[model samples]
Target: MLSQFMVLFGFFALVLVSIVWINKAVRMFDRLIGDGQPAWVFVEFTALTLPGVIGVVLPIAAFAAAVYVVNRLSSESELTVMQATGYSPLRLARPVLVFGVIVAVMMSLLAHYLIPGSLSQLRLRQDEVSRNISAKLLSDGEFLHPAPGITFYIREITQTGELRDVFLSDRRDPEAPVTYTSSRAYLVQEGGGTRLVMVSGLAQNIGADQNRLFTTYFDDFSYDISSLVSRDVVNLDEVAFANTLEMLRDPEAVATRTGTTYGTVMSQTHGRITAALLCVIAALVGFCTLLVGAHSRFGVWRQVLLAFGLLVGIKIVESIVVAPVLLNGALWPLLYLPVLLGLVLSGLLLSIASHPGVWRRLMGRGRRSAEVAS
Candidate 1:
């Protein structure tokens, strides 16, 4: 019961820490965009995203907390007393594993379903913000540089989506400068991009020998002012989410267009399976670590650090295994190696914990050191 409480408490604490840390990291990038949005907007964004981060961090943190709590109990000889009262090591490990399984199932749901849905919503919100210029985002008599190489200067923006004393300059062309002026303009989305629907505007072109000018008096005109940047086309299957059954079902249509290889697809599929298995293996590893180090003088912090290191190492190995599938098709089997290594390590830790000789040696070492000091 105590072990279960420790696991639950640790999961929540670690998840909260992960949310704050990730939010802090994302804000640094958000500030660069100069959106003039409040910090609370970013905080809300981070809060909505906490589940995804928790899904990834919870399993590992639960593992570490279990190890720390169990090891501390054993080191203080509390576990010894429990054993004297007929509580077996396996019996102690059961509650920890049960807690780990519940966390694993929850994380699996987040990773496979909830995270993707939240990410899609985030994209839509960003798109809405980008395409629509809110009055709140604008300040009177201040130049706004919302997108690269595009600047807008306005004396005031009215509540009815009208700009006064507006000046627009687009420096995308170095050889020829394009300058435009309008008494009023409104924001609009066209052709998957944002455009300024300027009315009663005149455009001027500056050249070496002469200046070319054009004036238009129309009800409405559209000027391309899109801020959206094109991204490099990476193979979709390389991403973990694309490996889902729903995605794979329409592979012939979607897969070929994504520019991904069969090996890359296979690796991504295996990676998801491996990730689910990792939760179980981490629990085993944590339980064993606690039991083997039961009599150690080191505090829980050391075990926490060690568990974090192990989790990081496992993630690194997972990436390394997937890299081969991206580079060479023949090395697809290498993706399985991380899961195999995790299993082996978990088994080894369990063995070390169970062996009578190993415990005897550890106890003997403590006795010898005490005797020498005496």
Candidate 2:
């Protein structure tokens, strides 16, 4: 059973990861390809994002595989034969429990190690790519919207890489729109960001509310493009990029380093731990929820749906727990409530599956008492 569970888990996990990876890759391609990036760059960037995607898909896949495998066994009468052989529900679930533990350990490794490393590398690469403004952002005869409310255009690019007839419009401030036109400009890397140094440029500012326009002419002017492209100040790290050990070792220091709070850092550290444990809870929920029902030739569609509903409920509890924990570091332990609840629910389901005759006898007695009363 453990072997079967592992095989099914791998199959389901691969299928889900492929679907998610494709969707993510398509969007990433659309964004990077438009910036004149090469096919290899596109592929590498997409590949770097896979570890984070796999971390998210692992638990869901484990649950799905557990439900499918358990239902398949039940439908084939294998589960019934095992029960007849005096195998209790808890005994039958031993293999599945081990399978869940294996999945949980894998998830822990991903959440703690692979995801953070890959994501951090991805961010650094993205920042590097963004800093190469001449190659990525500037294109001759094309209107480019690098950021919301900002548009740039270059009429021609000289062999020396100088931009000719540059036009820029900034409408980030709704009340004031600024437009700049330059006869010539050069993109220079400065202070870890791209700067457009324009010569012989005229800047025009229009005020929407006051209905006023102001024009300024200058021989040289500069504009920074890093903030426009959503690139963090180069070398600045975020909490998400920090490893679990770092975050846990000194959450306060991590918070200070990442420009976040202790609550956020501790939440992230504990969240990763609990997120890994959720894989085990999800597997148990899927297996035990199905155990609530007796065998049926028609199929266990109802039980499958019930298992899904339970999983959803657990996730809902997780969402509810996250908000408070994020607000207060002291509430970090609340994150594990969903796992505890799942264990309790799974235990109840196993008890029901184990003593099917006891429940039937109680129902029969109730029916008899009702007849006598009537």
Candidate 3:
């Protein structure tokens, strides 16, 4: 049972992560490619995002694997055979609980290390890419919008680093939009700033009266374009980029760095712990939900559906229960409500399974009510 659960969980996690990663990769492709970045940069950005994606879907995959393994065993009568050999529900659950723990460990590793490290690297790479001026402005024969309200184009470049046939549109000041055309342009750096120097250029703009076009011809012109492509790398201050242990050690430091309150920092710390614990709850709940039904050749599909609903319900409860933690950090322990609820529900299911007569009588009562209504 443990082997089956692991195999299915691996497959499910792979499929779910791929679906989500591809969807995000599309947006990454547009941003990187539009900025003249290479294909490898886009790939790296998408790859760095995978750990978080895996963390998000790991619990669901574990639950599906558990439900599938349990339902299949029931359909094959292996579950019944085991019961005939005096296997109590709890005893039968031993392998499933071990599988849940394995999944929980994987989630914990992701939450604690992989996700935070990946996010930090991703932010660093993004800052480097943003500050790559040549990549942002060096594309020839293609109009580039490096910043909003500005368009730049270069027809060709010489082997000696001279720009040819440059066309620039500056609509940043909409009331006085201007266009500059030059036969030759050179990128110059002086006083720790970059500028575009155009030789033999004509600048056109609307006249003050707004009734006629005005053009000014110059032998040399300098335009400051450093603002277009050079931006300071914003600090990576998100709660997700910080390790949970760091937050626990000094919540005030994390709160100040991330620009969040003490309650929000504590919420994030406990949220990571609860996220890993959710994997255990999901797996155990799925297995125990199926165990509540007797083995049947027809399959316990109803139980499988019920288990899925309960898993979703647990997630909903997780979000709802965490609201208070965000308000008061001392209430962080309440974040475990979803896990506790799932365990209690699993225990109830096991108790019902251990007593067949109780389940039968409940089913009997349900049937009598339906018959009376008919």
Among all candidates shown, the one with the greatest TM-score: 3
Q: Write the per-residue lDDT of candidate 1 for residues 12-113, one digit (tens) a residue.
A: 657676666676557744662356455665665665567666666666666666666666676678877887798766676677677667666766777677
Deviation from native of the Cα of residue 282 in model 3, angstroms: 0.5
**Candidate 3: what lDDT?**
0.88
Error of 2 at 344 (Å): 0.4
Clashes of each: 0, 0, 0
What candidate 1 gets wrong by more than 4 Å, as runs, is 2-33, 36-44, 133-150, 155-164, 170-243, 247-254, 293-312, 328-333, 358-374
Model 2, residue 77: C-alpha shift (Å): 1.3
Q: Residue 344 error for model 1, in Å?
A: 2.5
Q: Please provide, for model 2 over 1-374, each residue's C-alpha lDDT reduced to its tens digit, 9 standing for 90 to 100.
A: 88889999999999999999999999999888878777888999998999888998999999999999989888998888988999898998888899989998998988888888888888888887875666556678899887789989999988898999999999999888899999999988897777899999999998787898999999999988767765457764788889888887889888888898888988899889988889999999999988887778888999999999999999999999988888898889898899999999899889889887898898799999999999
TM-score, structure 3 vs. true: 0.85
Cα lDDT of all candidates, in order? 0.64, 0.88, 0.88
Where is the poorest 10-residue window by lDDT in model 2?
Answer: 227-236
Misplaced by over 4 Å in model 3 are: 138-150, 154-164, 169-179, 184-200, 203-224, 230-233, 359-374
lDDT of 3 by residue, 1-374 (tens): 78898999999999999899899999889988977799999989998999999999999899989988888888888888999999999999899889988988999999899999999999899888887766777788999888899999999978887989999999988788899999999988867777899999999998656667999999999998888864665788988788887899999899998998888988888888888888988988999999886556677888988998998899899989777888888888899899899989989889888997988999899999999999
TM-score, candidate number 2: 0.78
Compared with the true structure, the alpha-carbon lDDT of candidate 1 equals: 0.64
TM-score of each: 0.69, 0.78, 0.85
How many times do residue backbones clash in model 3?
Answer: 0
- Regions more than 4 Å wrong, model 2: 145-236, 361-374
